[model samples]
Target chain A: MEPAGGSCLLGKWGHPVLQAANDTFRLNADFFDYTIIALYFAVVLGIGVLAKRQVSSSIDFFMSGRSLPAWVTGLAFISANLGAVEIMGMSANGAEFGVATFHYFWIGAVPAMLFLGIVMMPFYYGSGVRSVPEFMRRRFGTGAHLVNALSFSVAQLLIAGINLYLLATIVNRLLGWPLWVSLIVAAVVVLSYITLGGLSAAIYNEVLQFFVIVAALTPLTIVALHKVGGWEGIKDKVQPGPEQLSSWPGTDLTGISDPLWSTIGIVFGLGFVLSFGYWTTNFVEVQRAMASESLSSARRAPIIGAFPKMFIPFIVIIPGMAAAIIIPEITNLKSGEGDTGGATYNDAILLLMRDLLPNGMLGVAIAGLLASFMAGMAANISAFNTVFSYDLWQQYVKKDKPDAYYTFVGRIATVAATVIAIGTAWFASNYDNLMNYLQTLFGFFNAPLFATFILGMFWKRMTATAGWTGLVSGTAAAVAVAFLSEDAFGSASTGLIGLSGQGASFAAAGAAFVVDIAVSVVVTLFTRPRDEKDLKGLVYSLTPKESLVDPDAKALPWYQSPTTLAGIGLVIVIVLNLLFR
Target chain B: MSTDHDGTTDTTPKKRAGLFDIRFVIAGLIGVYGVILVLLGIFNASDEELARGDGLNINLWAGLGMLVGAAVFAVWARLRPVVVPVED
Candidate 1:
């Protein structure tokens, strides 16, 4: 399995995988687009300069002064959310599964956003907290708060670095730059704006970038569609039945045999675990909710955000699907001899974009691609700075520090995060794949965190000991699945309403959740509960009325709670998937 | 955190969230974006024009229009609540 020619890992050449990696560093024929890439960096830096003064306070620095309206929030939400990992991941899915991959948008994003708007935001805002972790503190306890804050920050930073690495790969393909140059250029451009402007700059620039991305993507889609012929051509060229694009659960009429309940398990597990983990628990997402002016605004922001989320499939994935049809010959070019295609998911995209777009327009498209990549880096560094400054530094290093000190710490945190992220990017450069790396990293902790967030919100009996137990148990289970399972959890478990490969990870996490919940209930029942004083803060966030005991105070209903709404949203998502499929 | 009873704060130093005047502007901005998206969908160029490789041109026109339209609506929304803040 050493170097030969981009082919299968276990091919006749006995080294196809090695050859693929070797060719990756070799510049493609269409390289020499550096001028366009440089222009993209300049625009990003300009945004940073424009946003320099917006970071005067911790609130301004982290939450954009909490005065932004729905559209800005909506735009920023999509921009910040996509990241490099997301773009490449989605495209990779498209290349692999065809239009069926669009299910992520339909089943994962749209419903998640709508549910957040109608339910989760109210609970989060009602809690009246600065960050998602702070809400955990009020709802559960300090231990829950601290652990979640620390773990999520670390995991997200890792995700950010992975995203930067994916971005570097694409940039390298477009400009023929070396991997190190692409990584450094990306880090500098993103860090410069982020350190100077904080959340305000991130949001403002994100709003602009969101538009730019759409502009680039929508056109790319049209060109791709035309190049491949229309819907009729796609139908003729690709598989038309469930074998290619089944959105429903397994055992459909596509005649393709599937793993047992692969569709149901993957989709449900993702919604119950991955979606909940990300939207309900992650700091970057929940932070946007915190930035709203009112609980109502917070509740509504994700809904507005859902509009774009719903169409993301058409914009991002369809192009990949189109590329798959047209460029099937080149697909898997990196897989070594006798492999599916020799290309990895990462390379498949660049090869397609290179072969497709006209030269002048390539500049704009590449810029949009970079925007997607850089946005992730900027948002993460911002979120990481906030966590360190607010959660760690404020609590220990500078408890009584001035606002000036907080801002300074925030900058320092940004620099630290940037350095680590650059390191992560360098580490990832050694790997040849994007989807496998991202899914593996996310699978490690996503399930456990999702379980804890759900338990903490709905079931009051969950205690600190239980939180610790659940997180640990969940991590252990996910790790076990990673090592022991056949598909390794994420690959086989993915779909619209059920598990994909990600579900196995969630299943392990779910098992941990069950154990944690059971342990917590028993512990809470036997051990005396924490003082009612500790419970008071939590009660207020949940019961926002004249009194907690009031019979009719017009308090927010439980149906509006994110946990409950997700349950209801799951049904709608399943139906949508079935309808579309 | 000290919360104000009866929706008014007298002794608390922490700023509270509410239906402040900025809300109406926010609601207005939402409406503006909604309108632009609807109009774009309605007045969209033919699928053929889009398919024949005018992707950037079409997206540029539509996205710019959306931005300008949304910005104008947001300004109007901001101005709308000014005339009757208390009543609102």
Candidate 2:
């Protein structure tokens, strides 16, 4: 009836024009929501049906027939990287931490991507493998493959669950629709496209959505900047205050906050251990590597993906800053009980959009939000089906199933993942209250899993025995830590056990990695190597004729090519730290 | 099964020069970092200068350097050997 929920729109001056503009965003007794949502569904369905004709075999279905160009794979790669959790979580972080929230994009993501491009991609592409797990088996053993596949799947499911929850949250807040209605509708839309189009459909739709989301939101940022009086207005509103924003070496360094030990601990444990481990091993991302058209393309996907990856802070994080500025009255409210729906900084950006965006633009923003959600969904579903069809089903169940059968199973896996994600989404409706619960669950599997993958990759000495030991040990350590802690999250120290919840999981994971590496090394030394022929296909880089034999040719003294670029980038990054600090 | 048979051999290299394009990789990564640095330097430089309570300093040198770096790299890559040949 009114433009927005505030008392102003419904009051005496509430006219028909404003009401119509508001109604576009307003979920309704009217058919507007249905009409728009149905149009989205129809478009995806049409693409899926079209993609169906192109699906000739398992390869065609899972990898878009492996005929995708660099542009297609590149776009899909980006959309897959940014999901519902990205928009909601990062936006929330932006509101809470201000500019410091941007550190995750710059510090956490960008370097990791470049390093992945240079170091990790070469290894993966060289392996000539279908999946990261397959790469694991060639380097380590089947044991490594099994551990990686299961841990990765669990992580993906948790991610999907988080995404489903965020999507439901947005829809629920907008229309006052029940969570199940939203989750089910989302599940159907996602499942339909992925099942029909396979990875190619996912990639195609993702590329479309990538453009849609970026195009739609990019202009809104300009308008927002304009409204906020450009640069000076932004500075006046929030000036990088402490507790709101800080840089890498700022509060953590210089004794501004803590001792050197705590600072070092954050850098080592959080920065190197947690961050590097995730970027290198995480499947939702590495899956893109497998989809590249060439070794070089595979290598470039993560790096190319890094470019837009840096802009995420500009597009998503700054909006939260703007939100804080325009909605300063609610800044305290964000931290307090004055919140609507699920009260937290997570919903702050959505709250801003609800208040600020004019009529037609609101629809576009909503589409961007939905596009982000679908991108995450398509990425995870394809990954799940990939692991399921390739690793689990192929290894344990019907090893000799036809490609067509695997394609069929890939579709079935999508449905199965959708069902599990729906249930997890329902549980995640309480995510604001259960942040620790979600993250702790992730840390348990992720910590040890990361160790195994990293050790397997860099250290050729790792063995199957070490792999299994690390996998089991990490999970047990994570679970035990989570269980013993007074806080819902795992503590690194306990009076009884002398370990905190966070500390325990880290120690457990780290110890497991150490043990896994040691065991793998010792066992590999004693045990025999795999068939050298099996290892033949690995070697992803294409060297020149002279360089191919010389092993040192075209090396360029390490400071001329990627290394030089990365070094310069690092210097600029340091300068950025000083400036932002 | 037929598709598996028809799949390109990943084990063997094409051996031919320009089989996979090195320029694309260089151009792509260069373009990526280029756009990122330039945009971040331009807008964020102004913001940083403003936040420093100074008059508008656009980080003109840095911005220009970024553009030059990107263009030089892109042109250099095109001039380098073209590998990873497409169907075309």
Candidate 3:
């Protein structure tokens, strides 16, 4: 039980988990491929050892001592998010929905990230809170802090489990290994690095993983696109409709049959509510930006991140779209021509990779997949440990402990959370499309938290009691919607209407957001407001003008300035939307 | 440690994260893999393998592309090694 899942972690894990087909479609990954993966693991562990030497305090452990530059944190910001969900789940969406899938990128992500950088980041960075929960604690008192900390911790563990299950499933199918062995091995690799160097190790490894992911996926996309004649070829091949090529009013992508309601859902439910809720308030990504050396760099982190983000769907989603055309199993499944060969949309990326890549490149792609899954889980685990140790443990159980004690507590929390994640992976195994499950989790956790946060940050009059009540009621509303809606919880749902897939998650999110705002407003009007004196840097209007932007920023050129760079990002994304629309 | 001529000892290096600058690690690893893939592409290509993605020697082309990526990252990291103090 204590050997940390055996000493031979990489030796067993080095086998590329590529095939989902029975025997007819094997990955054919040879010696060079395994060697590449093995070498990548060596560098990954080596990074842990290097980063460990930098950690001497709790701040250093959990926040990288807030010393990382903007570029590193910026790259880490996006990389930490380039987990199993982005690679596998988005690609799955692509295989199912085609070019309409780009909505998740251009509409669902970029604008919110730019907004986080330009508008909301000032309060977060200007206030000297260690974690998002700590910020909540200062603003709303213990009730809100406890609720935020507990829910955020639970969400991280569950999301980490999703990454764990998919990685293990891939290993199980490809190598016929037992699920426990694969799960343990995958868990141990992330566990080793995070426990050793903490967030510093996680951030550095994320930057590496980001590049490996780009390098690995670019080849696969080019090859897949070449195999099909191009986007024109894919459109012609997957005939019978032109709707797949358009990004707006995506009835199929949203899982809502009515084009009008689907556009409303995509815009209000997804583009505004869920995206802002996740991108702005979620601590997992926020932690990266928080680790930056300067407030301006912190502010610039997400804006810098948005540049690469604008183009990622071209590589991720397009390949999945190609798979639906190029691969026989998926083609049959999409066209209803024959049996699906037991392949789901989740296997779209792996199926395509198995069909196209050669041995050496195959190894690189496998390593890339492994990097992404680990990056996602590592982000979750690192965030979990920080909140557990600092916000939960130190605040409630062991107050006034030495900083070193908290650092030790953080390491222990990482180990414990990784083990718990192994158990939660079972829950994720029930879903065929992980995006639905992930979106449901976000709707439940992030939507309500975003409502509580956005209200408190802007309105200053919202009291402590309003904060926790709004959070609880908002979450309950989302869960209630999920339960009443058709196909959200499978058998648990009442099948109340035709709502299904991403549309159901969006409905749940929308319900949470509206209910949370309404409840918070009502609760605030009834309760005593916090003193305006206490709301100095925490609230928008209360905060001084000087606190928001760096004084040195005025001297810097337009490209380096946060708002200027963000404007550039906005224009490019708008053009991308225009071109794709 | 020797004191300065002004008799002031140096501040502890707690703030310096070293110019080991993580980009070198990113570049070096990607470059190594790129080189290996290029080697394999050159040595182990059959006509059947060449015909897989429009007869384009994918491993070789991908390897070259990665090497270019590695160079760009390494150059970016070197040209602007940002470790000095800035306004808080």
Predicted structure with the largest TM-score when compared to the true one: 3
Off by over 4 Å in 3: A1-25, A426-442, B1-19, B82-88
For A1-581, candidate 2 gives per-residue lDDT tens digits of 01110011111010111100111234322242244344445655666776776677888777665555444565566678677656665665566557765555566556766677666776665555667777776765677678778867776776676676667667765767776798888888888888887876787677666655664455445545555677567667764445455554433221224445434534554455545556666666677665766555555566666566667567777777666666543466554545333345555556665555433334445666787877887787788888888888887789997778888888888889989988877666554335335544555555565566666555544455766666666666655654554433423324344344233333444554555455556666776655444444332222223321213314434432444445555565566656665
Candidate 1 colliding pairs, count = 37
Model 3: number of backbone collisions: 0
Over A550-573, each residue of candidate 1 has an lDDT whose tens digit, in order, gives: 232235466433344445555655
Ranking by TM-score: 3, 1, 2
* Order of the predicted models by DockQ, top scorer first: 3, 1, 2
lDDT string, candidate 3, B1-88, tens digits: 0100122245533222234568778889999988988987899876777777768788998999888888987887666543423223
Candidate with the greatest DockQ versus the true structure? 3
DockQ of 3: 0.32
| Stretch of 10 with least lDDT, candidate 3 chain B | B1-10
Q: How close is candidate 2 to the true structure, as a TM-score?
A: 0.73
Instruction: Supply the TM-score of chain A against the true chain A for every candidate structure.
Output: 0.83, 0.81, 0.93
Q: TM-scores of all models? A: 0.76, 0.73, 0.92
